[model samples]
Target: MSSEVLVEKRKLKNPPLNIHTLGDRVLRQSAKRVSKVDDEIRELARQMLQTMYSADGIGLAAPQVAVGKQLIVVDTDPEEPANQPIILLNPKIRRHSDDLALGQEGCLSIPGVYLDVRRPAQIEVAYKDEQGRPQVIVATDLLARVIQHEMDHLTGVMFVDRVENSLLLNQELTKQGFSKQAVKPVEAA
Candidate 1:
């Protein structure tokens, strides 16, 4: 939770990065790990935060903005100006609690499509901060859920793909004018 990558948590009329939507090939490709957490990466994280705020989202991954890097930004309490956003470079989940929680999730990449996804109730994640210093955090509840959802983007997995109800998934996508064919489903665990 470095404040180094902090940006004014306000909606930008025009966000720095353009979010690629569903059916875009960029959203399907796995992201590469960041070799260095330099100023360039910090800038990307800042812009991503701005974009996420503009879109009224809690978290965002680099891949969502068509950047093939294992970077993610999360600010669950965006309404709180003093809350520092989490800028994770090359984030990896170190551990997850056995308890599973089913919650509704929405993605900036796939707007207007919210669906239920089951994930670990808690997670321990290891990642590099904006200054290249290593950091580890244990997140639970909404923070855990948002981090998991954004992490899925790094591996080109959308929340819609993890959704169990095919009928509702298809229906929601259709209503949003998105083709159901765009979804590449993940086999249930």
Candidate 2:
């Protein structure tokens, strides 16, 4: 089966999946690797894409929807109908550039909270396409940052965890009706 999934990049009245928010235990649990790429996985990816678009998000992960599969859907240019969304199964960052960049990021799981986080500006990722064929790509800039951000969800890590400014994080979380305690801060590498 071709990895291409044809989904209109628009919000649906009701997305196929429910996106869990921050402080939800489901978001903190690690995702399991997909052993097989089949129709079931494809359908799940389709639903995830719909949910992401519905939530006005450029990327989404299975764990965000309370699924434990190591899957992620990303569409950086949703306005372009010709642009196909990326679906990766068990994606791994094979290599990263020494250079880093700070970019603001927001999550579907944690709505209304955008903060600056530093990440490698470029990365080489290896993963299986929707058809289960192994593939690799070197991504940079926005695409690289989005990929890294979504991949973090697979390991139960949220962008807020990487946020360095505690005051801003707390203010944003509070303003968004989220608790600061929900953030599990990670040390900068």
Candidate 3:
């Protein structure tokens, strides 16, 4: 995270943006592609990062905050003093590895409901930087998972929608006070 734009700079006393929860119509809406990455987009990214930190989240997408733009902020390393948060604008997956792995995942929107979801072990993504420059990253492990998970948001998909364990998914969503009907299960490919 840059010193000037760190979440701390936003003063967590109150996050400027509100994260929409599961079953919300906003989360179901697909985000629009950002044609320009200007100060407005950068500010939204910063605010999203702030809200994520406040909610103890590692990744967040524009749709989570009801912003219909293809923007995402990810901080795979939040505990480390040198936090490296990634700001991606209009991200698109270019390629993904054949290997798939199941990982436990949770969401800021669907609080307290964590479940296992399968995802590609590695991926190559093309996205614009905060400054509007094109960039690509080859990520593996947690980084790969985070990118995929957030990308799903861009297309109006939630992690629960990909969970194969219907039993566990129902149990967790019920326990978290979220409706099971909110989940739209997609058969894994």
Instruction: Say which candidate scores most in lDDT.
Output: 2
lDDT by residue for model 2 (61-153), tens: 999999999999999998898788999999999999999999999999999999999999999999999989999989999999999999999
Q: At residue 44, give the lDDT of candidate 2.
A: 96
Clashing pairs in 3: 1-83
What TM-score does prediction 3 earn? 0.94
Candidate 1 lDDT at 7 equals 92
User: What overall lDDT goes with each candidate model?
Assistant: 0.92, 0.93, 0.88
What 10-residue stretch in candidate 2 is worst by lDDT?
A: 1-10
Q: What is the lDDT of candidate 3?
A: 0.88
Give the C-alpha miss distance for residue 74 in model 1, angstroms. 0.3
My TM-score estimates for the predictions, one after another, are 0.97, 0.98, 0.94
C-alpha lDDT (0 to 100) for residue 124 of candidate 2: 98
What is the Cα-based lDDT of residue 135 in candidate 1?
93
| All candidates: CA RMSD (Å) | 1.2, 1.0, 1.9
- How far residue 66's Cα lies from its native spot in candidate 1, in Å, is 0.8
Model 1 spans > 4 angstroms off: none
Worst 10 residues of 3 by lDDT: 1-10
Kindly give the stretch of ten consecutive residues in candidate 1 with the minimal lDDT sum. Answer: 1-10
lDDT of 2: 0.93
